[model samples]
Target: MNIQCPNCQSIRITTKDEGKKVGGVIGAIGGGIHGISGALKGSQVGRAVGSIAGPAGGAVGSVAGAILGCLIGAISGGVAGAKLGEIVDQRILDNYLCQSCGHSFSIICHAGHSEPKIVGANFFNLTD
Candidate 1:
């Protein structure tokens, strides 16, 4: 099915994949920063625990703590990034823009029906 522009009745439309890609990149960067923060916190805690156990113990504990922290941070960051990307995709990247009149809109479908409808048009106040 073809989607027409509400402003000019043009069939030329574009999807917002570029927006999605931008969102994904932003999410990944945020996630990486969060992960780094988590890793630093984990290492600090580990070092403290190791110091109480003496020099050798502290050294071992710090290494173990850093490794564990890094793993946890990476996992949490990845999940958070994926969620953010999905949110961006839904809220900003899944739109259909009119190429002819420079109008931005979306295609919506009601429940129990397959036909999509166009929104963002001032149908009641159409201009010649």
Candidate 2:
């Protein structure tokens, strides 16, 4: 669907996606914390697994496991955070920008209304 600016009827619009950004960051942080907890277990497991190779391998494995754990945690957390943030942007933030008018707005659904309406204005006073 083509969204036009309510004030100027311009098709050049940008979605703010503020919520998604925030959510993604938050989720990632939470996920990273979990990953850290997991990392300890991962390090133990890695050491045992790598020890089969040799003494040097065991030492390498422990470090590798910890790094892997941290990486996994950060990545998962970031993705989750971004997804949640997107939902917030759509549902709560004035997520649309009219390039022509520089007006920020959100598409809102009214109760018992069949169609969504373009609502709100200049929430961010943003310029590009």
- Which lDDT tens digits does candidate 1 get at residues 28-68? 56656666666677677877898898888777777777777
Please report how far candidate 1 places residue 20 from its true position, in Å: 2.8
List runs of model 2 lying over 4 Å from the truth: 110-128
lDDT of each: 0.63, 0.77
Backbone atom clashes (below 3 Å) for every candidate: 1, 8
| Residue lDDT tens for model 2, 1-128 | 55668777788998878888788878878988889977887788889999999998888888899888977998898998898887777777778888887877766544245654545434333432
Residue 33 of model 1 has an lDDT of 65
Off by over 4 Å in 1: 17-19, 37-94, 108-112, 117-120, 123-128
| Candidate that scores best on lDDT | 2
Q: Supply candidate 2's per-residue lDDT for 112.
A: 40
